[model samples]
Target: MENKSEEKGITRRGFFQRILVGFGLIISAGATGAIASQLLKSLMPSGWFGEPYVYRKVYAAPITEINQVGASIIFEDKANNRKAILINNGGNIQAFSLVCTHLGCQVFWEKERGKFLCPCHTAVFAADGSVESGPPEKSLDQYPVEIKDGLVYISFREPTWQPEQYFRGEGL
Candidate 1:
């Protein structure tokens, strides 16, 4: 009888075609994955990849625009994953971290009281950052300030990825 196995088996040409198709699929998948990765990265906001533990100018505003004492400006440092507050304290400009020393709760400037207040547990901090009252034993972290020409600039150490650890209060 004729070879039954040969009749049912793939021919040499068919085997090669199958192999080429498999390789083409793999290549296409790899190319698509690479393109998708690039597209996602491009859609993210700038400075999302900033390195930790580096000090940088977090914010700048015109001193002339402050208008009044106790007026404050707040902003997020995306690179550091932290918040900051800049206040005009009686003609003296100052900047401080908004993170409360007690439990990392964000603090806010009380323009009427002229101090930073932590609403989490009623923790109160003077505009200079000293803890006025509450459970916190330490003062709020302060950032170095620079006045250039007509603008105010504040510099602070960028927060790291480590949990519950920050460079702000460590003399950075």
Candidate 2:
């Protein structure tokens, strides 16, 4: 047989080996770029990718409204058609929706009774928004609260967090 390497110069084995090296370098560069992109995303501010935030921090009320130790500031999220309460319960601040768990009626704070009273069905909730008695099977829905820039903010969770809502067309 003829010696192909000594004549043709480009050996098949060497060509394949060089092609494999090029492929490996390309893959390595792609992987490195992917990792660097993810790292840069981590350093960027939230929602910088032009996506909606997981939870929108809506301005609820002014911090000055929460003055007394036992005072509560009621606020409405007009865009959402929902109402909530921001209470300074002896310095332990908290907030939750006023919607009744049973039939979606509005609940009111009865400070005299130190509990929430649902007028539609007389369902009673404890001071901490837990179901104390009546027709409701669950407690009131609580939300995350934040204090910044001399204002109080309530975090309204996006519907995308619950996948089931999309199937039911509720998230639409």
Candidate 3:
């Protein structure tokens, strides 16, 4: 065996040395991968992959088109999986979440009654989101409304920072 290895130019010592070097390279590669993963994680922005709640413009309608007071317009936010009601009350525009506070049922805009009525439990919320009747103890959730450039933009989430102009309507 010794003569055969010597003829092949590979000694027992060299074989063990190559095995150790192979293990060292494997260990170094693992360490390098770990370091790179940590570096990438630190460099990435916070909440980049997380579901951070953000105030997004859910509905936009021209002010001139909203002409009727006490009339409610329903806007569904598919991105946030929620619904909102935009009401023009005496020229003052306001928005409220359509999810009933009592049992999370979808509430309907009762234009005749001038309130949001949840048919699930008969919970009634006034146009101002105040509780009118039924099992609901708290008022309906109100979203912030911004009127910019003759357009009404409604946001369902509370913004962490100042939101940029969402509705840019040159002809609208």
Best-fitting candidate, scored by lDDT: 2
Q: Which ten contiguous residues of candidate 3 have the minimum total lDDT?
A: 162-171
**Model 1 over residues 1-172: C-alpha lDDT tens digits?**
3333486587777778899999999999999999998888777523358535756774567877674876788756565465677777787777888889999898888877887889999999998899999999999988888888878878877644443334455433
Clashing pairs in 3: none
Tens-place lDDT digits, model 2, residues 120-140:
989999878899999999999
RMSD of each: 12.0, 11.3, 10.6
Off by over 4 Å in 3: 1-52, 158-172
Clash number for candidate 2: 0
For residues 136-161, could you state the per-residue lDDT of candidate 3 as single tens digits? 99898888999888888998774342
The lDDT per prediction is 0.78, 0.81, 0.78
| Candidate 1 all-Cα RMSD | 12.0
**Which residue pairs in candidate 2 collide?**
none
Q: Which ten residues in a row have the lowest lDDT in candidate 2?
A: 44-53
